[model samples]
Target: MHHLGVSLIVFACVFCSAVLGMYLHGRLPDHHLNDESMGVVKLTIGLIATLAALVLGLLISSAKSSFDTVNGEVTRDAANVILLDRILAQYGPQTDDLRVLLKQSVARGVQIISSNDRAQIASLHTLDAYKRGETFQRKLQELTPQNDMQRRLQARAAEMADEIFALRELGLLQATGTTPIPLLVTLVLWLCIIFCAFGLFTFPNATVTIALFLGALSTSIAIYMILEMNTPLDGLVRVSLGPMREALTVLGQ
Candidate 1:
């Protein structure tokens, strides 16, 4: 689901709970509305609020970690691609075609990574990317090295290509990872309970209502950020493609 959709749902849930609390307050007996009874409820809600805060903090930390890891992998893969291209260059003019194929595969890989389309990503394993990669490998195998230097360059280039491919696959896996629905639902429920308690004791006036509304909006936005960060590639927060783009520029030279 889109981030806005999730945020709206959260807003509705918490806002409705506050409204319900207001309705209950008006109907409750005078004895039940005493400060002593409300104090106990406030204490219980405070504990729930503390637990919810802890969980939210953890969620944000985990999501940010995942985002950073994926970005690091992207940067590493881009560097590896450029390193392989340079290694191939050292293998002499015979490997020129392989370098061309390397650039083509990298271009395609970057395009696929930048795309959010499921069909394109799903067909990634069977695409021309692997075909070009295999052809490049075959050409590497066909090379007849004249010296230890050429042979070593060829071996290192081959290893670099493998690492780049592995990193790409890992990135794809990370793109599909999401926050658990159950956890989000639980968090929303806890927030609603806390908001309900806020409404129970506070006088229902314009100022109080505005405060509750703003509180719910802020909380919903936090949840939206958590969800957006969890899916690095398809949301508002995305890893930059500058590393790969720069690699391509350097390789062309």
Candidate 2:
């Protein structure tokens, strides 16, 4: 779902609850429920909070999954490209020029992945570059006979293409799926205010002692961290491309 759509849904939910609660309070004589209803309300809130935590946990897990998938794809794609470069190198003088081109392609790809914007990638002429790889592989067919090693190399090249496409798709999904930080901030702030209002409505015996506050605060902070990670390349929390860097370091090209 789009971040804006989700934000609207969240806002609607909170707004409905607040309006309903206010309506209930207004309809009551002296704004009081049955004398012994405290236990029920507390139990309901506890259950609701528990369920909210469960849903929030699922959301966090989903974000983590997407982040890992994107990172893993990037790493695998980079490694595959490097392996393809080496396989082409095995053609020696016959494919040396093609190998050089592939090497340059891999280098430029590394530079693009390290970038935070798409402009550099566009300037690299990705489509034209991909055609170069295809041409190199086609040339390899005439140079290297169908030996076991050749077969394996060909399979690896194809796999590399798959990984590259998957990584591109994953990157797009990650960029689009991130929850807007502002929406989160608004959601949590309103919830806290609503909780405070609930406490205020319960005047005489109401207590939000330090210990309870601390526990709730801790959980909120954790969810906030998950939101940060969901944002891909933004903020302190992020998905690592350590494996990509490792391959780049290995080539030293």
Q: Which candidate is the best by lDDT?
A: 1
TM-score of each: 0.92, 0.60
Q: Per-residue CA lDDT of candidate 2, range 1-253, in tens?
A: 2333444554444444444454555466762565456556666666656655665676688778877766666666667766766665563455566566556656666666467544664454457755765675565555654588766765665565556555655564564466546745554554544554354344322143333344445545555556655756544555566766666565423
Lowest lDDT 10-residue stretch of candidate 2: 203-212
| lDDT of every predicted structure (CA atoms) | 0.84, 0.56
Q: Count the backbone clashes (under 3 Å) in each candidate.
A: 0, 0
**Residue 87 accuracy (lDDT) in model 1:** 88
Stretches of model 2 off by over 4 angstroms after superposition: 1-35, 117-159, 171-175, 179-194, 201-220
Relative to the true structure, candidate 1 has a C-alpha RMSD (angstroms) of 1.9
In model 2, the clashing pairs are none
